[model samples]
Target: MSCASEQTSKNPMYTISKVTQSQLTDKDIFDEELDKEITDYDIQEAAYYAQKGFRVPLKSSIILAQSGAQVPDAYMQAALSNYYNVSVYNGFSKNKSSSNRRKDKEQQVNNNYMKLLRLIAAKGGQNTIIVYWGTIEKGDLDDKTNIVKWSQYEGGKLSSKTKALRYLLKFTLVDVTTGNWSSYSPVNIEIDYVPPKIGSSITDALQIDELMKKSYDNAALLLSEKYKDKTK
Candidate 1:
């Protein structure tokens, strides 16, 4: 109703300052310097979060994302903050999307899946001689096409038509001891892969494959060396 309000209503430039204000304060500052602040928070929180939870502010997410690697402190810090949950730092009106929460979901499924695999391995090891599992296939476990069941049995509770436990970790164990190693004749080890629907987008699939290939190829070298003496 006032002159400035009327002018703002008619002119886009008048309202542009509001957008600038939104970015600079009370929101995740995307500016390079603000990103640095976020990274510092992330690293400090990550080192402590196992002992402290929500106390880690939204800014600390940088550490959460990058703590998986071992690298120089500066690069680790930068990577930790490089990508973030874009949804948490901004207000609801400004959020328009929620990537942060989605990332947590994906991580939850993957972590639980890995746990389940370890459980299976433990069971196999305990019951008797280690039971060799063949390959894992992604999606639709036997008669259960319902992904919710898959996710739940896999230790999750999210049910969406568009997501899945899309990553699989697979490897075969080999015995490399000599004559005693003959007792350790090499054997291929494997885990079934059921790539989750949400996590297995083409890009993710490629990354998973790359990891698996590298591991399997390295594993093969050990097996090959073990069998070489026998063949000769």
Candidate 2:
């Protein structure tokens, strides 16, 4: 796992994609090749959008998951699947009778999510979206389900009133033995929203002032009518 910076504004990032497996032969070479291909895709995508009069600003750093202790196999596996562009399971069944290692694996994923949440929360934007993607190598592991986890804060939950953000499902993988990083499976994360009950309403002092003015105006008008005959 990677160390998180103090400020998210210092490094705000949204990943495009990653490779799914790290066990592939010539992994380093494969990474290079994928880099080129991904770059081309990004360029072409940008050009296509530009042709359509869309303004897509590319300004985000690469965000890697990190841990202070020895990383668990589950976390590493998820990363590898993401790196190599494969599928990930949306949910992992908790094994109550499993070894301590299994519990640690589950904890690792949660920890990474918390870290990302903190980073995004620290950002200055009123509406900031963060995407957490996971996947397993195609036929490499028994669990072939594509996992694309994303943040669903209470502020963003959808109901009869509001709509949640939009995102694409994606992942990458890593090798446990060789510590090799794989290519990235691309996913998309997009969100546009306004929080409920945002901005300030009328202040108490302002409200009081308004009421006083109305009362004074009514009193003055009443007195003018009452004294009309005397004045004339």
Candidate 3:
């Protein structure tokens, strides 16, 4: 997927929408034409709010399904949707399984998110980007453990009364890029949130983190189950 680095820093980003399918066509994606069109929609919407002068972030959703699907359309219609765009590098692949496409999309999307998290973490952490890199590079790259845990942090406390803490979502940066993985640009960002109290009654913030963690895993599992080696 393409990132608008030059255009993005003009404003900050926050708020994320869930990934969904859209009903775009191959003719729509030729030469990234469709993404550009929608990205323009995102820019205009951002500008509209920029004129009003708000610190709101440019938020967009990733494509979890095919082109021209409802998720993208719904996000496009969101009051905040205008500030964001959808992406799925493999969404238009006519030769791949929908599940595999979704997994690839999840990996790629999370990698991008991790970059943002890394920047945020670096603001107050002892670890530097170089240290983070060395850790990941030392392992069997194919294994998930080889991935870099940018660092761990306390997302928040469980409660004012209970001394117990909630989920500790590890901010992981894994490689999901297309070519030689020298940069963090094309990777998927995974927030492996593991909550503390997983049962009922409590906030279960850890559960929330677990759910986030499962999003990527589920995408991969679904892809493997549905497509096998059929990915194009």
Best by lDDT: 2
Report RMSD (Å) for each prediction in the order shown: 25.7, 28.5, 20.5
For model 2, how does the per-residue alpha-carbon lDDT over 1-232 read when each residue is reduced to its tens digit?
2223221111101111112222112221112233234668766765664454311122212223312112112323333332222221211112222233564564322222322323443352211111223321111112344433334321212332222233223222232222232333333323333334436663322332233233323332332233222322
Which runs of model 2 end up more than 4 angstroms from their true locations? 10-29, 32-162, 167-169, 176-232
TM-score of each: 0.18, 0.18, 0.19
lDDT of 1 at 227: 31
- For model 3, how does the per-residue alpha-carbon lDDT over 164-215 read when each residue is reduced to its tens digit? 2121111111112211011121133233223345455534443433333343
List the candidate numbers ranked by TM-score, top first: 3, 2, 1
Candidate number with the higher lDDT (2 or 3) = 2
Query: In model 3, what is the error at residue 74, expressed in angstroms?
Result: 21
Ranking by lDDT: 2, 3, 1
Q: Candidate 3: list runs displaced more than 4 Å.
A: 3-205, 230-232
| Candidate 1 residue-wise lDDT, 72-121, digit = tens | 11221222232221111111122222333564573222222122323333
Ranking 1 against 3 by TM-score, winner: 3
lDDT of 3 at 162: 28
